[model samples]
Target: MSHENAKQQDLARATTDERAPMSTNQGQPVGDDQNSLKAGGRGPTLLEDFLLREKLQHFDHERIPERVVHARGAAAHGFFEVYDDSLSEFTTAQVLTDPSLKTPVFVRFSTVAGSRGSADTARDVRGFAVKMYTPQGNWDLVGNNIPVFFIQDAIKFPDLIHAAKAEPHNEIPQAATAHDTFWDFISLTPEAMHMIMWVMSDRAIPRSYALMDGFGVHTFRLVNAEGVAHFVKYHWKPKHGAHSLVWDEALKLAGADPDFHRKDLWESIEAGNCPEWELAVQIFDEATAAQFDFDILDATKIVPEDLVPLRRVGRMVLDRNPDNFFAETEQVAFMTTNIVPGMDFTEDPLLQGRNFSYLDTQLSRLGSPNFSELPINRPLACVANHQRDAHMRHTINKGRVAYAPASLDGHDPAATGAADGFHSHAVALEGRKLRERSPSFADHYGQAKLFWNSQTAVERAHIAKALSFELSKVATREVRVRMLDHLQQINPVLAAQVGRALGETAGDSAAAVPPSAASDKADEIAIFASAVSPTSASGRLQSTRGLSLLDGSQPASAAGRKVAVLAAPGSDASQILSLRSALSCAGAQAMVVGPHLGPLTGEIAAMATFANSSSVLFDAVFVPGGAPGVQQLTEIGEARRFLDEAYRHGKPIGVLAEGRALLAATQLGTLSGLTATAASGSSGSPAATLEAQGVLIADGSDVATAVDRFVATLARHRFPDRPLAAQIAA
Candidate 1:
């Protein structure tokens, strides 16, 4: 079999027993599996009920230990293919340079702090771990959605997770980091300021797993066939561009639907809307690294895109959902040490520690050194090794010799020479074994300020509001004040905004602290104080590229977006059907929502109801024209709130003919995008009107024109600048 079919064949063999007759582990026929072996109906169960004991025992031990972090996850099966062989000059990794090969991959997306049962929409880091089954071996690129981390060294990883997790004394807040313990830790760790800015920004609450970017967070090395190495950073850019949920939508989604992200991924794949991302890398040599002021080894820092642009290497598409969640997604294991010959580890302290910790963690979680034997984790490459069996061992080695260099077996499994086997890059090193951090990692506020300065005005306001909201949850006043001091170092204006929200002034005695006390050292600041200036030392745009979500460089598409069409009894079925057909042709789903489930009209049926679904769940709202239906909708409270809430959240809304009555009945006064004219007196064909503010209105005859204009507005996602002075509470 070819490399592509090898793993599929193994999985087929393992799952062949599915849908067979029910049986015990020993393959005995199970006639009464549901009731178990029992005594008389009125009497106590017999002690000889072996079937009952077996079922209960298996059920009790079914669940393995969830991960210490990133326990909540969803996964898919996919394939990764390179765009061309352009990267071959920099690395001998065939996975990145082989355009003809489609390497099989399994990707798991997750939230960092949540447990197995936590909601998927928490404001936290998202894990984007990928395991590629290559011809040479499996390569696991375990990363997060954000480009940076809260701490620089892996030694402080435990402390970071402990502080971010729920408080231990009472376990008060479930998956949130807004409590006192988290802010207390963050207030003291000055080095975490850069990552803090990212976490508190809109990037923390992604709109969807398929709409966010992924980063490897640490620098590594790419070695070519000649043993030459170059420092590299890995990135995964979504094909449709990165987007995020507003804070209000994220909070409402947590209570309304905990599995929002997981459902979205599964449905998208089933609907033939596969999620795609381009695998890009930032490649540079040692000379380039030395020219930078900040340390590339620091995990909390980012190498700005303007400094080193990304080179698109390959593309990955997730087209298949898992068959069994436990057998595949939950049991899959990924380790950072699983690299091929072309890739080697850098001296990044955090990466070095992770290379050791990942392997150790699997030993405890999977309960065996034989986790590699599992079908999901198994590589397509042939296995010929001297290692013997352990717990859960699936392989049966032949012959009497289990040790290497054996004479009895005629040295059958000898090692390949360096030319064909894995080789680490040879780099000269001279350093004392000390516990001190490099001085290059000291200037943390420079990048924090860079991020704050890169945002658009609206994005900046959102970040300020997020910081105020998170800090307001902390009960300890000192922790909030200390954080304000650190923020003052990053940007005084930001500090003042958050302080005003907290009912304190930024430079007050309770919050003011010397610059030296706020940072590692007062002199360290002078090293990179000009880093965030409009122009860098290289005369490049220093703060704008690849930082903001609304940069307009990212492409927009209408695929996979959902729109809700409101309907009621005696609704205009023809208008609804025409609009639905137009949206369907544009690759968007149009769901008819009514006051209750079932038929809303003779030809139209409600797929969703106002009571079960909220405005926050859809990308936009549409109201069809029908005097009776519009009157009925005007009497419904949910129908009225639906329009009000959609307008308040800046979502696009479309109304037709009599449907304008329902839109007008809401408290949204003087809609900016309304374009109305008398249907009978209009001389020319009525055309849909769309303003910069995302709202559309049209007569009943212009369904096609209205849909085209409405989709264009939906592609823009939202209008954050819409005037909300007349907005009413939903």
Candidate 2:
């Protein structure tokens, strides 16, 4: 049977309802689920109570050993469809080249260093692992949010992970790399500088999983029917555009809502606002690659778009949230070696190491080589393997002939020719057994500087602040100085700003009063500085497309954004309804937040209460006009705090006629005074003086006009550099 039919059959067998009658593991109906069978309902449980025994046994083994890395993650079920058959020219992989095929896929997004209980908003690399049950077989495109990795070779992966994780001696910090040990490792590894710039930038703190880009960090080979091979790098460009949260917002979210990213994904999918990304490929040949200054096999570099542009080939849309978190999301396994016929691995050391590591990890954590038999990990294609299962073996082999090419079974399961089966690309290989890295992978600072130069001014500022904050957390002064020395090689201005923030100089060991100690410190800095060449291909390219989240080409749609509409008992009924409807029409969720829950006025009800909600939860705020409502809102301390906090965070606020009084009364308004208002007309009518200041104001009589302006302003997201925003109290 075809993979599509297999997928349909699997979906049909999956449980659709959780309200079914309760039963034991053996499907025996249970009469009592609240209490276990006991001697007299208050005595020790009877040994004959199979239901109690089964339940307790299952509960005892419910928790599996979590993954060493990427322990915390959110997953979804989706389908991938190619845009056209143009990709077929490069590879024969049906999933990437067949426009008519709807390949079922499961994607998991995760943080690299965090444990199972870490905060979702922590600054770290995000894992973007996609498992596609293709027609031929399963293909797992395991990748991360960043295009480059910290190290060039996979041999250092353990060391890198060890240093980034909690200190082994004390296990002091969890899910963060700000401590001294992490810096100590990073300061010594010059190859880590390129990736360090990324982890310390805003990209580490994404606004939502839906808004970040995903990359296949290593270059792989795409083989066509003609046996021609091309080097390819895979990219997943978010359809909504790559965006990230402000540093302050990310920090607050970690404390206020630890599951912020996971919740955002689940709620958006449930609400029918599915997230999407376009699959793009940068395909090049050996000749083209030879002209590049850096090696394609290096994991610490990226092939800039300016050199080889990305070709948009397909799109993946995640429309369904997982039915069961543990059964589906947690149990699903992704292996780098699970590739189809037309795709083959490159000689990239990191890639080769991952090809082995991922499978080993699954075997260790899933507790069996038969992990592939699990429903979530099972392939949609038919299985005809001769090998039998080990632990957790669910499959029952009917025939006695387990071995292949048996005369007794008429050699029925004989292998097919190369053309009819999966084949690795035939490439000439030459190398002696060695433990040294290639010279081409030596230049690390070039790409580090390139990433720094590609960011917008505000983005660069955030990067500097992040570096300062992380380094400041390191108790060791030498670690901070060493990191600064590397940063100086990447960007002197950035290094200077971070050094000033830390109140220390890059190469100055003034605190080391002893001459010999200071000389030793200076020598270490010089060694790090000499390791990486500053002028390379990546640096010469200047800036590239798709690096900055605030670029002008990014989408300005308000779809999927959450807006908080603050209302009170006396809020204008028409104004409230009109604003909510307008926001809904824009595909944004406008939730009514009031002093209390339930009914607020005629035909108006509150969905969230001030005591239980904060402005940080929403993207923007809208206050409807009414004399009594404005008075009530101003009297509530939470309401004032919400407005003030929102303003301080640079969120746009819209106030109508009487509602304008509430804004003027807040501490935020006092800093800049209530701005001027414009004459009201229709939605098209603008010229509101306060609109320039990111505050849309209108007379109570023109509620429709004001709401239109407000929704429009909300679509633009936060207005960061407005004059009023500048005056708000920090």
Candidate 3:
């Protein structure tokens, strides 16, 4: 363990012993805590049992209303610092321009559709909301893992959420969108096709909150000191680079560790592997924006990186976990309108709706119009305003002057001029009072096709598999076919692949025709899909490498990875220690797992046992060699099964000397073309040999070389190229 983890362990142990006497809510000492006060020790309880009354009363109201969305979340405290003041040329936001000031930030990551108690590993949109307390004010860049949203207009948000959430009839499904209602709504909403592609991709199921990318979703305006405005989109590129769990791994993790992503984030920070993201902005002037085929203000579209490159301005590092989950993570409110003077909202319908919706929802959920007074939401800059108190108001506004423009207080707390205070961009507005979408927002499937074309072969396969799985769960055949029609509009190949999985005919558009029950919804879908010719899609860039997670831009490193070292009685302490040391040196975590906890002979401590840990919890597994250890592990069913399951999941495995016998015992060893480098006489470099098959084998020689090669193989995360049959049962 590292020094940071040691300190964390100490802190955890320190909290085990209660130091203070138990007391009531009023600090009154409690004489009896176990049993409620009763008459004659068995008779009816009396009203004088103040302790019981207080306990039950508090318990009754202990839980507050969870968020309407993003209820399940994890949060951390951090600081943001700029690389330079170059951003000043684009915007006057001090947080982006000042390199000397480290702005304090609280970031909350969440699953959008899940309740507060839902599993963290659910395949749902992950919310990436950041509240930065700059010198100017609190700026909240509320975003998500995917850049686009399902709906283009904020008015349709309620409908979108209603469809994505559990069906209202019985609420059978929880924290999942694979149901009739969701697909039914999705099929009718053509504007959502682009976002659907993203949701079905592996990005929806992130490996960890620290590894996924975040985007501000809506395009906004950044005003400079000269009163010039530029369209901007915020992006947070993870230093570890974007990565995700395979669908099978994700499914198993939801059961094995419901708090998997949350625990991963908290533990990574505790282990001193603070997650970092570079804050970049895609800035384009009015002329540049006009050059784009589609509207720049469309929330469901993305500006290809090839057209306008990202400007890296600053970086954020989350180094501290929240002291209290509810006090910090739950109560923290992120409003889209909470931007500083330099930043302003665009006319994107979804964004305009969100600006009002966020504040309105916070008022009801936080039980206060004064939620900003909460520590996590409070601005670092001094607040001076004429606004009065409401429920849960913490500040006692002194003096009688509560309104501005009054002579009594010399117009104190008065608004400043455009140079200092917020000034809306001077873009002229002239429009009739009508409910209509802009003609510019008509093309929807173009970007969806672009996203499809951008994916690597492996990613495309995953997306197809995901779509197949989700549609398979839709009980309504009409809903499934309707969705296939939309998918065909985006990519005919994708629709055909998914169609095959549903046991339906391929290449025939008639087969995708909605059933008679869905006829009523057809006209609505046609209105959106038929209005535009989708000509803009042809002019759009063919593909952008940035859109793919498997592209060469993503960094491949072992840092922050967790490895489980399978061990048992008479385990080779030397080999385990060397491998653990190597992993730690690469900034990864290594834990020894055995049949039981505590000493596994010598200095090697069994951090977790088979009974308590599962292979799903770790990124990789290593089996250390020892004659006795191998024999013991062979007898332990879970120990032997662990390797088999790990192999089936495509996780990298390392085996030494006698440990090879344990591997040979599993079905993995019997697979055709399986090669154990230690036993194979073919002369080749160890890196090439091990990496080719994601399996490293070694005898009792060259311990350092073997461990180094094993660690390298583990860094690759997964070897999809390995020739292993999918039909092989673990």
Candidate 4:
């Protein structure tokens, strides 16, 4: 097992231990929390009270600066193993060449705009950054869920983030970009169109971290031992297949469980269903780069899989969660510039700027350049860099030589020769320095059109809905119209829908917004990439053959899953026992929630043992048929709320006979109308029952088959098209 997995198992086990209840920082057990310590019940609190001061001080310091962007994230530990070092023609990286070697890795997944406290189910791009500690050095693949980015240049990065984050003046919204600032920026920046389509699709709201893909946004250069460089784009394809939640389901989840993504990551790792992704790259020489229509430096485009297929070089499995959330997950630092010896940077201006900025960001965030010394961020390789000393500096250089030189340290003071030292590709620079964008870095709509055309019908609908919602929030009519005009360039139907939502027409008006570009800076406004008319606005609406969630998710078995049976307080205990046994046979845990919290009665050994496992604790919940239990819970508020929240979160709702009535009594019966379109035989309309949206209802004659259908529904994550209320109950 990987070191990370072992650590996670230990952490998972630690949760079972009781660490003492509500104590002061000094370890004094508090008798009451409603009021602060005082001389008397009404007397003023004494200033000498150390416990109160300590408590308040600790509470005050509870937060750190969330990330400027990509603040919300989850992390896991893993290792990378290379396949064949056939890339000796391009990269001389030792880890890639040595098949027997393993590189320890840490990965953090995030959403670009949300704060650390934001909801996890937002429809936004995800950040997938991996830090691999190779023998030579640490290589961090800082990437995003979408293969492309919103802008081509890093100078525009601040602008993109500022726009996507909550709008200024009114901070009413959090972790969502359904406002004018984001659309206004993207509509003007044609390069953003391609990424915009993806953000609006179901892919942005992934079912879990295990079910999505990651991409290194910029094209980087890999140099071989011979110093020959080849451009490459990194990709991480999930073995479970790409998946997402329906827009409505995502919204419901925001309210049901804001930490949905993080929880999923922790639970999956602990359950022994660790997630894995294949690290691959699209490699091409200068000749191929020149042959492509778009500039190789452009971050907003991709070399379609049809053109240059990804070469699987290594695999990464995240089998463990962090032991300390603050130390490991929070303090883990990732940089785009953390490259190995053979991997080199391109003239790509965005990549160029990022190489310099990351160091500064890390220093400011981690409080020291010695951040490399942090346990989570520390590299496995030996380090002798001369750089040292800052706040919280932990290292003590053994030698007097702080700079790279010969003198005091004798034979070795650090640094190496051309054969052993890090080398940068020696490329000639002939062009005059300029402030303008390269002419070739235009034509944003082609790929945007390609992405739009690549999506399924459900995808396009989500896109349209997302655009409409974002535009609807624009306070300025002109800003709305301007955004629509740019979107119109990409697709008239999309622009028209957004325009209608904003009550305006698409046009080039003086709709410039301040705080992005300098107020005095002349806006040389021109539609750089004239958007192509969408071939058919609906785009591709069918899931790629292997993309369906129910058909694609992993494990394919119930191990740590929870099955809840709403049994009667004093009814047939045997029936419930039989039910629990069946579930246990399938490797599932079963809990019975009776009319009351105390022990209940039933007849014979058939009566099952029950525990009060709240719906919150289960991956999936079941409703076993019991006339008394079903009748009792159907009329109760907490029970209804429990089912409601579960359905809203896209968990499966299994009913046995009368369990269906209890479900219908709440607003869930409407889900029964929707059956799943199955794989085959008595399929009982698996697709209809689950509908790939947010709700799934089983109406098959057999209860076990219905349970199987419900289990499959749980695998899918959410039922997409059903009403929000119905989806939650089912």
The best candidate by TM-score is: 1
- lDDT by residue for model 1 (1-730), tens: 8985676555433322576666668876665554544567567877787777887899999999999998999999999999999888888989988899999999999999989999999999999999999988999999999989888888988898899999999987888999999999999899999999999888999888989899989898888888889999999999888888888889888988889899999998999889999999999998998988689999988889888998888899999999989878888999999999799988888888888888888898999999999899999988877788889999998988887666685764565555856898887899998999899999879889889878766677677778999999999999999999998888776787677679877874423333442233232222223235677687644585888897687777767778889999977888888878877776778899998999889789999898899888887899989889988998998997888888777788888878877776766633433223334433332222334457676766777787687788777777765555234576
Per-model TM-score versus the true fold: 0.91, 0.90, 0.90, 0.76
Rank by lDDT, highest first: 3, 1, 2, 4
- lDDT (tens digit, per residue) of candidate 2 on 1-730: 9997677665434441685666667886766565677898479989998878888999999999999999999999999999889878888999988899999999999998989999999899999999999998999999999999999888899999999999999986898999998899999999999899899888898878998899999999999989899999999998877777777777778888899999999999999999999999999999999998789999999998878998998999999999899999999999999999889999999999998898899999999999999999999988877779689899998777887567675665465655746788998989999889898988989778778777765567668778988998999998898998898788765676677668886555333233342234343233222222324555566567667666565777677788888889888888888877888888788888998899998888999999888887888888887778878998898888777777766677888778877877777667654533433444443324446757776676777777887877777776654444434454
Q: Compared with the true structure, what per-residue lDDT tens digits does model 4 show for residues 1-730? A: 9997676555533321365455665666755543566889799999987767887898897766668988889999988888877767778888777778878889999987888888999888898999999998899999888878788888999998888888778875688887778767876787787787777777788867877888998899888877889899888988656666666667767876788889878977887777888888889999988977688898887777656877888889888789888888889888887888988888888888788888888887877778889998887888766787778788887867677666674756464665765788998888887888887887877777676555544455567677778767777677776767677776665565455456665553323222222122121111112233434365522112222233333335454355666666544465456556666665455666665555665542212322333454455666665567667767766666556666665566666555555556555544444311223434445334443443444444465566556655554544433445433433
For candidate 1, the per-residue lDDT at 182 reads: 93
Pick out the ten consecutive residues of candidate 4 with the lowest summed lDDT.
Answer: 519-528
Give the local distance difference test score of model 2: 0.82
Question: What is the C-alpha local distance difference test score of candidate 1?
Answer: 0.83
What number of backbone clashes does candidate 3 have, counting pairs of residues 3 or more apart or in separate chains? Answer: 0
Task: Estimate the overall C-alpha local distance difference test score of candidate 4.
Answer: 0.69
Comparison by lDDT, 3 against 4, better one: 3
Q: Which ten residues in a row have the lowest lDDT in candidate 3?
A: 523-532
Off by over 4 Å in 1: 1-17, 39-44, 412-418, 508-533, 536-541, 670-690
Task: Report lDDT (CA) for all predictions.
Answer: 0.83, 0.82, 0.83, 0.69
Give the poorly placed runs of model 4, Cα more than 4 Å off: 1-64, 84-89, 412-418, 504-621, 633-653, 663-730
The true-structure Cα RMSD of candidate 2 reads 8.3
TM-score of candidate 4 to 2 decimals: 0.76
**Model 4 RMSD, rounded to 1 decimal:** 10.4
